[model samples]
Target: MTHKDILLVEDNPDDVELTRLAFEEANVANRMVVAGDGAEALDYLFARGKHAGRDASQLPAIVLLDLNLPKLDGREVLQAIRGNPATRDLPVIVLTTSAEPFDVEASYALGVNSYIQKPVDFEQFVWAVRQVGLYWLVLNHPRVA
Candidate 1:
């Protein structure tokens, strides 16, 4: 099996840096791809726009998606991902600051694999990332695409 990378869809520079640091602290060796917004994320996944010619079959092992994003929101992104046959089964973990019940329910309804709230404390954030890496990268058995 090919080594799959992780896709992080976020608009915040600080959050992006924090996620990178957290993954490093967890010793997760998988490559990380950053999309500044939902549109970029879609492009990356679909190999369109600037991501043209990318191997569409080489999908990310997991997607850490933020609920609030520019261009298109995370919910819309999730809907698109699930709507497409090529990316319908891709694992998406909604990593955001929102703890609203509606958001959680809607994400599940859209077929998100997991939902995680961003931790305010740096250490907690690292721990959360570590757990995510351990479970999704190390243990989860993904469906054959």
Candidate 2:
């Protein structure tokens, strides 16, 4: 399958820039859609508000989510996605700073495919982003077409 795009839901500007650069360095040709909050992420996914007229079939290959977000949290966002029949099977990876056991368990319970903690070091962060992009965007076999 082709790497179409990735939805990156991150609140921090530095992390967003790093993730964008990492995807570029990894040679990941897919587009990166940045959503600073959970609400925007949902809008992008469902083609609501400013995202109106978006083709629902053009869902991103992966969603990199942060737990702490404005409007709606990552858990609520995950539940919304999974609850919808159209995006139920979409691949969502919880990538956040929190590695708390409760966060990990709750994310998995919400149907997150993978849960990863952000690295503090800049270089390590880049590497982690590359790895995630590679694994989810290329190596992962999706549950649906």
Candidate 3:
């Protein structure tokens, strides 16, 4: 709503750069705000701490979440988001290196919109990120206010 296309919650810098490159390659002119940890992600979403006074109505079209985070972690973050009425239906995609069956099942059970495994190869990773960005940014219809 605030001209941001995606909220990418990731701690790794390399992955973040790769994702940015992929989005650029896709030509999606989206305002991306990066949160290094789950706590920061919540702060950004809830407009807490440094995000205080920010507009809460400016929810991103999609959230690219990583499962393993420093503080709260992705599972707790997802739970918090789902528990909140304001962000209850917000679309979330778990994009991480985790491909464990339990992780996949848990993410799905916890109401993730989608789960994507990070590709190891650089080119493949870029391609995957491009696909994700294109789909979520261009094709997906979020509850735009």
Candidate 4:
């Protein structure tokens, strides 16, 4: 029942726009905070760099991560999140285009809550986003930090 922010760690502009549209169309109430790359996402999560003034205690409800990214890359970002006690339990969904078995296995091994391949079709993508919102934002119960 508690509404928390959603962190979107993605570098592609087109994908970002599509995600935004999907969330909007799905009527997801949580605010989406975008980080263009892995480093930026980490900065925001840890309250460093441009996000220095942010309250680090207030973490996002879930993170939608893309494997291919500039700077740190999603695997590194996932490791960092898991390594940090403050963010270890935060739900992370790997929303990526990669359908590779290794990628999926690696993500699961790194403690990703879910892994979803990006649908090429607009409607399918929207449906996936809606399902994600419904599950992570509305249904799942996270531990109170």
Error of 2 at 9 (Å): 0.8
- Give a tens-digit lDDT track for model 3, residues 1-145: 4456589999999999988887777776787889999999999998898898888877877899999999999999999999898888899999999999999999988899999999988788878877877777778887743
- TM-scores for every predicted model: 0.97, 0.94, 0.93, 0.97
**What is the Cα-based TM-score of model 3?**
0.93
Per-residue accuracy of model 2 over 64-139 as CA lDDT, tens digit each:
9999999999999999999999899999999899989999999999999999898888788778888887788778
Write down the lDDT of every candidate, Cα atoms only.
0.97, 0.90, 0.88, 0.96
Minimal lDDT window, size 10, model 1: 1-10
* Error in Å for residue 2 of model 4: 6.4
Between prediction 1 and prediction 3, the one with superior lDDT is 1
* Model 1, span 1-145: residue lDDT tens: 5568999999999999999999999999999999999999999999999999999888999999999999999999999999999999999999999999999999999999999999999999999999999999999999996
Select the stronger candidate by lDDT from 1 and 2.
1
The alpha-carbon lDDT assigned to residue 26 of candidate 2 equals: 77
Q: On a 0 to 100 scale, what is the lDDT of residue 8 in model 2?
A: 93
Q: What is candidate 4's CA lDDT for residue 114? A: 98
Model 2 poorest ten-residue lDDT run: 136-145
143, model 3: CA deviation in Å?
3.3
